[model samples]
Target: MSNIRGFRIQHDSLTEKQRIFIDDFSKRYTEKTKKSKNYISSNRYHLCDWMNSLGFKLSLKEMLYPIISHSSEGAYFTDIDGNRYIDIAMGYGVCFHGHKPKFVYDAIKERLERGFELGPQTVESGEAAYLIHHLTGVDRVTFCGTGSEAVMFALRIARGFTRKKKIVIFANSFHGTFDGVLGKMAEDITIPVSPGTTEGMVEDLVVLEYGSDAALDYIRKNADGLAAVMAEPVQTRNPSLRPVEFLKEIRKLADEKGFLLIFDETVTGFRVHYGGIQKLFDIKADIVIYGKALGGGMPIAAVCGRDDVMKIVDGGYYSFGDETYPDPYVIFFAGTYYKHPLSIVATLASLKEIKRNGNHLQEYTNNLTSILVEKLNNLFKQKSVPIVVHSFSSFFRFITVDPYPFVSDPIELEILFLLMILKGVYTWERRICYLSTQHTIQDVEDIVKIVDESIDEMRSGGFSFTF
Candidate 1:
């Protein structure tokens, strides 16, 4: 079993007990999700479940189709099979307030009843902008449709404001599906991460080791042509990594090098704290992009930054009384659905709720998640499981330990996710999970028990985990 390397489903490695478990599990899961499986298979041409595009294997055939959600409320969502699962996925961090939050839903419904009024500015846009500025301490705020759009516009604004072509991005940080931010480390050079993206698309991108002294030195040496340094304050892939000192040093360099420091806080913004990582780490960035929880599950995004930097969007803000015309170098920035009334209304409701509760809401949720993570980790340790739980605020992930001899194949870890689903805990593809404001102490206890039982079942099947 230790010789296995990748995600191959080696039938020979499975013991008799494991095979029995797999057969039963597959049959039950298939029967439960038969409708979803058939629907997805029939719509294969048009509907692409890209998240589970890891290829078809016998081991994963029954578990491939995502549980079709029939209804959701609070910390639980019901699948089409009428099964309710504790929703730790939490809409991929968009449901900090939980599924179907009343405040946001009411706001959207009210706005819908009144009017959409798409073209002209909505009544809620200013309030949303004001709330964001107040919450994040940014001098200006701009609206966008999604995280990717906000990221692309933020990069353009950085470049336009700084008049520099190159941007510094860190390794192991995801900035969205934007083509410009899709560069990966290739030996000593940075290259496009996807096939369609050419070398020219990533030429201006400088990818460096995240939280390393070498990366800081590189930035210092090449600061002349650098417009911005972008990063996810706490990487989602590894939330335990809190590079506080490293980020502070980067902030210093941004000050000295005349480059804008951009924080891609799409996931971390409101989830980590009311002010995001900037408040958590006490390091300010020139620009910050916010999304996910900003609109309370509504599709909305925002770019907030210093006034001088953001003024380029509207040509430096000239008033009628002031003799000055719109004089600053203007950059093209517009979207047909930039501030859709529903999105803006939802955002307003979310921001207002955050304002009313302040950091207490975040503190309670973070503390709750911390306790849950500790309970899970202690259970893992007591059982000699080769996995560690780490979290940044309410978001947490199960990280496998390195150099463990017992865990032969990655499929063993994959099975853990399936077990989680079967045991009534909805998790993500990468094992990342979130604790929403709606999650209770009882929910945490229930999750811990589920995990303990799941691990015990897997252990009985000779699925190895080294001490």
Candidate 2:
């Protein structure tokens, strides 16, 4: 009877029928994914996939192994066990163009064949930078190995440019695992969220609510010492909540207060709109960190911004063998694989395709997702289920209403995902999923069908959904 707001359900809390279902489900899942489970157990000490970090009771442990992906194509992937699924997870948004997009894959393959030359600038870097500038209207672009790395660099640039130490972040927004930004909201200032993150790392962080008048007031009161206000524009976990007005206000404040506005668009970048939240809302940010879909399913991230703010990269722009020289007050920015050829080529290919298709690519996918969300919500309403599906562009999540009489157990919430997996849908952690450009009306119909069947099965198995 405890309505615990926790990430998981305890095995002992299930009803007798629920327990029987779990037992049978776990056995079948383990048998189906035996190789993956064995691989996890064998590499338990060596390999660490945080997606499988949640350790359940031994009896239910079999449900934890990720599907060992053998191959993937547009809108679908085949597991090592030959289970092909409509991959709504879409590599957690990295495959916005869908798995193994030919344009990106071919570019990467060509780059690999050409062999990456070390200590030299990549040939495609300029083209990639141009595409980014053309799309986002940013003046400068810098690359890194991952989103976390790009976040760190963005913070460093903000501090260097403004000569200020503090930053403002929002609660319920994830800005990668970078130590400086991994802070939880506190009474006044932010505190480190993870154990290894020292208190001093987040000493200058001010964490507050994402979209609130109180948070805006706090920022206004303390704008002088703040270097930047970093936000996810639209949070990855809770796609339903869109604070366009709040973000526009923040943008205005950033312009007036003389502090940078950093949009951490690691997950939202091209998935929502080709130009990300900036174009979607017609609000420009001082600096934007991009990853996920920007990489074209490759490992890459970028920090881009206004020329003046981004000038901190080399202190100030200088010409070759001219009066202007590299400024001494520059922040050190370097990475061995900063502009790796393969990544650059992939980015170039993806951006070009996006440009060729214009905004239609995103518009089509976003429209499809909206239709899918409406269908699922209609089903929930018709069945009187205390559940609703919310979406922002291609991203969507299921939310269960609290203290609802139709839902007597929290185990039912977890079972929805298990049933989804068994029914050939690729669900990821936190019930977050993304649609790809390859997902068609047919795919949406299939997803709706699977969801309806899962709900009906749960109802028949004594899971309450009636007032």
- Each prediction's whole-model lDDT (CA): 0.85, 0.83
- Model 2 lowest lDDT segment of ten: 1-10
Residues 59-108 of candidate 2: C-alpha lDDT, one tens digit per residue: 35558667778899999988877888998889878899999999998998
| Tens-digit lDDT string for candidate 1 (1-467) | 32111334534456777788777878877787777677777887887766544533466666766777899999999987787899999988989999999999899898888999877777689989999999989889999999999999999999999999999998778788889988877787778777677888898998888889899899889988899999998998778788899989889988988999999999998888999998888988999999999999999999999988988998666778768887557899889998999989999999999999989889989999999999999998888888888888999888777645324435566777778788899986645689989999999999999888888777776776546
TM-score of each: 0.94, 0.94
Clashing pairs in 2: none
lDDT of model number 2: 0.83
**Number of clashes found in candidate 2:** 0
Off by over 4 Å in 2: 1-10, 55-59, 404-409, 465-467
